[model samples]
Target: MSGSFGGQSAGGAKKARIEIIPLIDVIFFLLATFVLFTLSLDKIQSVPVDLPQATPAARPITEDDLVVLQISEPGTAYWNRELISSTEIPRRLLDYKATVPAPRVLVSGDDKARYGDAVLALDEVRKAGITVSIETAFRATGR
Candidate 1:
């Protein structure tokens, strides 16, 4: 009797083949998951409000109507070019709002001013219901 020492049957050994279908499916699934995650990153949650409509006959605002609120490095606040205390911001904002028909404010600060002082002034302006803008250009002195 002939002896077959190798663990192969009478048929020759089958060739090893790589199955790529499942690998392609797994790669596609990972790509899809990453795409979906990236798409959701920019979702913004915000409250809805009814915005005011503009009129064609509305009067244009002049430079004289602009109010500049400046904050200094020493934690003092300024209304236009006048120095003021921090505690007086809210009262002044409210008074300005009541006096000006279309109140507008420009919040500015010295380059070395405290961030909290500027934010405090901005918060007061918002609470007074006035239109506000920020001054991005910095000056050596608070103005």
Candidate 2:
């Protein structure tokens, strides 16, 4: 078979064209991916804490040893083994001479005790030129 070619004198020439649909689709897909990533942000979680319970120790109280100041739930306070008013703590402590050896104060408060009472007791003990430490009872390991 014989064929006739179009154009000027012999072979034909044409300008190449590029398709834009695929390019446009790729751009849209990237934009959608970025938008989704930005929309789904990270989240955090937290929890509240509860104070721990204390166990009673198997020991006895003695005088001229480590002094323990207990502030009971009813707002009553004790110095060593004696029940004394809050105001009398400083005077009694001051009257105690260095020769008698004033003992370290251990302020023990009830679970439902007021924070102010404990802090005030510590302040008074410090003012009386005495050292202080917090007392905690240890749980028994065996029966």
Looking at model 2, the pairs that clash are: none
* Top candidate, metric lDDT: 1
What local distance difference test score does each model get?
0.83, 0.67
What value does the lDDT take at residue 69 in candidate 2? Answer: 78
For candidate 1, write residues 32-116 as lDDT tens digits. 9999999889778999999999677378888777899888866587788888888888888888888888899999888768888
RMSD of each candidate relative to the true structure? 7.9, 15.0
What shift in Å separates residue 67 of candidate 2 from its native position after superposition? 1.3
Candidate 2 lDDT score at position 48: 75
Measured with C-alpha atoms, the lDDT of residue 48 in candidate 1 is 97
List TM-score per model, in order. Answer: 0.58, 0.45
Model 1, 23: alpha-carbon shift in Å? Answer: 37
